[model samples]
Target: MTTISALTVPDERVLHRHELLALGYTPRRITAAVRDGSLVRVRRDRYVRPGTDRAVAAAVRIGGHLTCVSALAVLDPEIFVFAHDHVHVHADRQASRLRGPGVSHKHWRKSEAGDVRLSRRRLTEPPASRHLLAVGDIVGQLVRCLPEREVIATLDSLLHRRIVDEPFLREVFRALPARYRRIAERLDARAESGTESLLRLLLVELGIPFEVQVRIAGVGRVDFVIGGFLIIECDSKAHHEGWEKQRSDRRRDMKAAARGYCTLRILAEDMFHHPEAVREALLGLMAGHPRA
Candidate 1:
């Protein structure tokens, strides 16, 4: 078996067979490297280093580019959102259907033919030769495809990361159908995670007036200050998993309570799974407190 280190080519983890041939690697040497487990065959023509990202490999296997929330999550895993349940790929409208347990194919539409071309022509940041969609196109597809609450969370994440500015996002919103335009208008960059964004959107729909990221005199900064004296804290396992964080959060809550603020801690699961329970609890609190 040939040594992979001996073959000098582009440094990218994922490489096309044609690229290797052009870089002076003979077919025999490439085959030997694959046999020796130095390279992994992701698809018929695509190869990647061992343990490459499954999502990218799936997209390449499907003969398309990653788009929508799948691309965004790959770009920034730190931003809290729902777990990416599948690999999302954008392919030609007439492309053959793809089959897999966790693969979702998004077919290009006739009306989006021009937009598709534009997305392909424009080079995305980091220059993803692995066939990831452009940021703009990804955002456009996300606004059109994802639910309203999810769209708000995604836009907030993009804005927080400065991936797309307000003006550019406004253009994306305008390009969407009229029904989705209002949803974009409700986006708040202050939302630190998808769960927080969803909670805020639900509160708005419930006609509850609340302040976000409010800094109380004793409490540093609360998630959502509702009805003036009610503080709603949204927590996730990522942020509040450890004992230290739990202790800190309890201290904050106690300090707020001492100052007449009723603090309610809402977990990520509560916000996503049992939203009705959350809504009913919020309504009860609002009714008792009455915004002062």
Candidate 2:
């Protein structure tokens, strides 16, 4: 019973002091918990679980909630690449002496109970965590803070995860500038990963005719099929490990080659970190093939 209840606090990440009190934690119990290293005092009225993300607790301590890429990073890790290596916060305009680690950007809003932000990003009530911004608001921040491709990647992940559909995205974009509405059209939930989303945009920019998740006989679905016969597989480093998996992939490639398909394997890391090289390689590899 204790273990099960423990999970709720950790999962919720941060809670107000009154909420902790309502949960039957007296001042002494709360203090003891803090001393025992189970509860962290984020601020006078905010308490975070020991396992809570540092950024979340820091934001709360700074009289703000996590926002922009930082909040999304916590809400959905591995969905979108980091826009910056720092945390972004949404704090009260009246709050002062604001300083925290890794908090590069702090968005200010009028202080209100249960009303996190409205001045900028026009945040709805925080869906799950008070310490976190709403998804639509986070996307709004991403659109304002990051470049086009990065923002689209965030939108793609949001769709792929079914956190928000196309219509909801359209509605949110409609409230933003005219150019943002156009970005919603480029999002496709079929993208299985951020790297895939980025690569799709790259292909579109390069005017490459390719299909995603194409399945061939004797082999399972591949990431992309280009030039009609070339199979491009995007994989992360994890896929390269393990001999059994490697053998299975080799066998699949052999089967694909037997069926007159040329297989080209690309790592997700290359697509993310060395995009120019990947682009050059793709351009050179398809130099002989007619654009389909």
Q: For candidate 1, what is the TM-score?
A: 0.80
Cα lDDT of model 2 by residue, 252-285, tens digit: 9999999888888888878878999889988888
Off by over 4 Å in 2: 1-11, 93-128, 290-292
The 10-residue segment of model 2 with minimum total lDDT is: 1-10
Q: Candidate 1, which segments miss by more than 4 Å at Cα?
A: 1-13, 22-24, 93-128, 290-292
Residue-by-residue lDDT tens digits, candidate 1, 1-292: 0112211111244689999899898999889988999887766667877786777666665556677777766666654446556566675454464323123344434353322221232322332446566566677677666676777887887666666667777766666668877876787878887778899899889988889998899789889987778999999897899899999999999999899888999988988889999999988887776454
RMSD, every candidate, angstroms? 8.3, 6.5
Model 1 worst lDDT window (10 residues): 1-10
Candidate 2 yields a Cα-based lDDT of 0.72
- CA lDDT of every candidate: 0.70, 0.72
TM values, all candidates: 0.80, 0.83
